[model samples]
Target: MRIPLYALLLCSVPFMVHAQSETDSVHHSYTLSTVNYTIAGQRYQKNYTRSRELQQSTDRLLERIPGVTMIRRGNFAMEPTLRGLSAAQINMTIDGMQLFGACTDRMDPISSYVEPNNMERIQLGFSPNGEQHNASVGGGLNFSLKQAQTGAAKVWSGLAGAGYETNASATQTIAALQYSRSRFAISANGVWRRAGNYTAGKGQEINFSQYNKWNLGLSAVYLLKPNQQLRVDYLQDEGYNIGYPALTMDVSFAKAKIGSASYIYTPTGMKLKSWESKVYYNYIDHAMDDTKRPAWQVPIHMDMPGTSQTMGLYSRAKWYYTNHFLEAQFTAYSNRLHAEMTMYPKNAAEMFMLTLPDVQRTVYGIDLKDKIYLGQDWTLSPSLTVNYVQSDIYTELGKETLSSLFTGSLDRKNLIWNAGLNAEKHINGRWTLFGQLSRGARSASAQELYAFYLFNRMDNFDYIGNKDLKQETSVNASLGMSYHQHRLHIQPQLFVYRFSNYIVGQRKQGYSTMTIGASGVKQYVNIPDALLYGGELYATYRPWDKWYIQSTNSISIGQDNAGNALPLIPPFKSINRIEYTPSKYGFYAESISQSRQDRVSTAVYGERASAGFTIFNVGAGRNFAIGKNTLNVHAAVYNILDKQYYEHLDILKLYRPGRNLALNLSLTF
Candidate 1:
């Protein structure tokens, strides 16, 4: 693994001389084209998706990106983390649309509502480059949905596809159709997927790992005149019998509905280069129970129900000139969430408990970005954002517990802002160096603000929210260098952040008055100061004409944190691959390795330790053409070595899937 990785890195330096032009971009036609490898400002008109990638979940695909980690509670909706930050710290949206997960346990991530087949592309903006999402403190991940294209051909077009995997007995089906004419276009896509229990590397079956899901999307586009256009989109997704063995309960049913209308004006006039405005709304409902898994047991029978309603609006405008560009945006959004868990005595019919009620978070924000070119070798970019956030916990029925503790109806208001600057210099014809400095802030999540007597499995503790908690803030800086050549691209960067009023789970000293079965009670508390620092190296190369190799290694550490280490900090990890794709066919072999995660927070947070393991994977595929359609085929075996292991990121600490084979076939015109 090291040999191929080093070869791919060392032999391509000379080839990079011809690609010096990559350091500068006007159209930004090529963004991070690869699956999981991207840097700030990476922009591409057409994204690349490997054949094998189609068979993997969206969360798994995102793992390929450096500094990105996935917290795997189950097979779906893996929580994504970057640079030791996750959840609301990283703004996640679909084409500028906001969504909130209904599950307090985080069983359903926003990404779960979007299927891979419905995605046109994904762009993640890091610090100093996230003008698109000003509220983000760490980064922003944006999913661009497939839309009806204007000026389409007279004939109708459609595609159909199916896929399967063995480890979980999973199956996938997909279909899409589109029609376009002189001025209007319409498109629709549907997807269905189902899976059973997944087998581990040691042949053990993890309960609550099965799920069935489906989604449908409809879109319409009209060319108003010239470069002006209008578009509308609607999407709905449903999941049934989703299992979460790691959590206290399993999800029985969940559904999401989202709609958006946007107007885009990109006139050739050039003075007002572009203007975009959108209005979007999304809703989610989820229900969970322990009955989904017969083997699962708890002291008391419980039912969990959750729902969220969100409305948002955004508009952006860019003015361009010869050597300078300026842009500004306005955004406002509000989300209301009602999540409650009720416990029923197994023997007594009259006793039940109400947990978590009346939580809402609303935000309004604006941002600006400026880019200036210095001579022919330097570029300067700067951005700023400000937001007003409000949190409310209304106990109109007097049924909630936290309201009594806080003495009255809970209300909190905060005004926050973030600013960043990035500078880049082109060095001759082979190297480029960049630097970034930013100060960002994030408002507390709904749970952090007002959850009442919530049970947390990760630390085996009952959690209560803090109404007076301050918003978390961070000051960060990073430096990086990039080397580009004909056959290789290598980029390495190091970053550090100092957090103020960092919110963490602090173990309550006494348990006498705490909820039952609680090892300890945890309350949101402010740690005066904490620090997180990390770095990652990404490299890709083509040693020969037909062979390509890629590798990434990342590590991060947290200090002055709540535990021995930052909660869920990933260990030293690497993914190395060698592949050959000459024509319509391709073949590849890969190795994934990780170091032992001994820096556990168990002493402070009662988190458990995790052992490390390595896994081998391989795949091959080919495509064929018939009539007017093209058929693409792919097959792969995961965990070829069948090594027994589980990731530290799994909050439930469940064993990862072992050896499994998958096959995919699709056709398109």
Candidate 2:
């Protein structure tokens, strides 16, 4: 029986209550949450203290956006599910551009490539299909890079910081430098992270060791015309890594090189009030090395290389009239992927093996949206979008036939659609209500159709893709209320999702071959029936000018035909934070709690019951001025009591790691 991830969280609630306490009082210069929205009517933001040592990436930053929940798998990249639709259903874009992650495990999302500190803001549309960005389908995330002062001349700035965490034996460092001149700007940022083996709650030392990574990026922007600009960027990451709880070989030496250039044009006068056009291209080359040991008399090491190239163009036209605001956009995108594998055969009769597959794909989309004000504090928004995709895939088994299995190439086409409507009303002087309904559909990605590989991290299992997978469709609706008082801001939202052709995993009969227990082969299959419902409460209160507190609670329930809770449907969770700022310094304490859940899905190996525990975090920082320099220093301690707990989404739970203390320090000029 599969155990639900949430059940463990619920069980930990009792412990959570005991770990929280009130700390010192100070005044904060400004709350990061309040700085996000310029227009207060329809925006929400959450902030993670710099002392938390959250991963520096766009995807991690999305967690600060209201109405979004991030289900993390590891330090790698998080998978986002908006209103019960995730993966390809969620549109992820960076700096107005889209790129595909090359990892077959979806380990490296485009968001993972962007450093969080490099971003000015991350925005999300609560209603799926409300707006279109490039080839986005269900929901859209926009990553905006930080910009220098509007008219500053020859400005220079930089920041440096480092953090250490006991859990997962993690340590990291970050630094950034920037320069801005009239009509020109340049910036560079980088991060280095490393961790040793970690011991779980059971006192088992998981092999999660020696995971070292480094990434560096450089960007430049130039204004060619008053209304036009050009930007170019380059990024690279090199690392040697290992995933805990892996039954076989650890992954090592992964590397990537990326580059992109974009031209953006905005004309002040046109048929529409304004029009903006953009085009960009990016390339990624990835490779990894692993040594398989299970089921073999001796170690079998191998190497693999994968590459992806992408190009895209998008444009938007905006029109404004007396009571109506309208906008339309079109996008074109294409990508190509190539991969090769090299290995050693154990038997003298057998020779080295290799598998290669080449894939190419293209997509086109058009979308339209309108907002109308009907008086009486009433407003309405409607949107529609359509998209199409085509792909060609081919594969070659170097040895002609390793297991005498038959395979064939595939060529397919797909069409997708989305529509949504939103209505809002101001009920009173301090309260407002809103409702939204949206329907979205997305076609399967190329990796879902043709991928076939051994995922050693999950227990030396082979994952096979199915070509017959169907498009997934979902309808979502939400009702919410917002309140603003002199010292508080609050929003509560409830939502439900009805799905058709939802995709899930199913075990295949007779395909059960494993070195461990009776682990059958599970493949992605389409489910015709599915439903999900949930609600969230979020608020920020400033009881006094010197103290601020924020709280958020969320719960979601999902089920299939049997009406059993879906496995890993994030259990009820809450986050509370109290912060105090003193002129140029800040101090904060935060607690996150999870309720235990018991939902389980198909049989999975090493799947066991999970328990919960509460973690305490406290930190303080201050900025000081030297004669000619500005410097800042901060420090924090995580898992204050050194609690032993399990993260529902932590893929290393099989080893049961415990939390450890962490510290951070920073300098800025």
For this target, which candidate reaches the highest lDDT against the unseen true structure? 1
Model 2 Cα RMSD, Å?
Answer: 7.7
lDDT of 2 at 40: 21
Report the C-alpha lDDT of model 1 over 1-669, residue by residue, as the tens digit.
001100101111111101112222210111122332333333212122333343356676577666668888877778878766887677878877878899888888888888656676566655624523756667767777889876776458877888898989999988888998878999998889999989888799987789999999899999899788999999999999998867767889989999999999998856788999998888899988887555436666778898888888889999877778888888888887887766677667744444556666677778888888888778887878998887775556423556465775477888989988878787856687888888888888888877777777788788878878888888888888877777777888888888889888887776443346668788888898888888878777878977777787889888665435768888888888887765776778888888888887677867677888788888877778888677878788889987788877888678888898888887876
How many residue-pair clashes does candidate 2 contain? 21
- Model 1 spans with C-alpha error above 4 angstroms: 1-52, 128-132, 350-354, 398-400, 511-516, 561-563
* lDDT, candidates in the order shown: 0.74, 0.59
RMSD of each: 6.6, 7.7
Residue pairs in clash, model 1: 15-485, 15-486, 16-484, 16-485, 16-486, 31-43, 31-44, 36-64, 36-65
Off by over 4 Å in 2: 1-85, 130-140, 147-150, 164-171, 199-204, 242-249, 266-274, 292-300, 339-343, 349-356, 394-409, 453-461, 512-518, 602-609, 652-659
lDDT, residue 6, model 2: 4
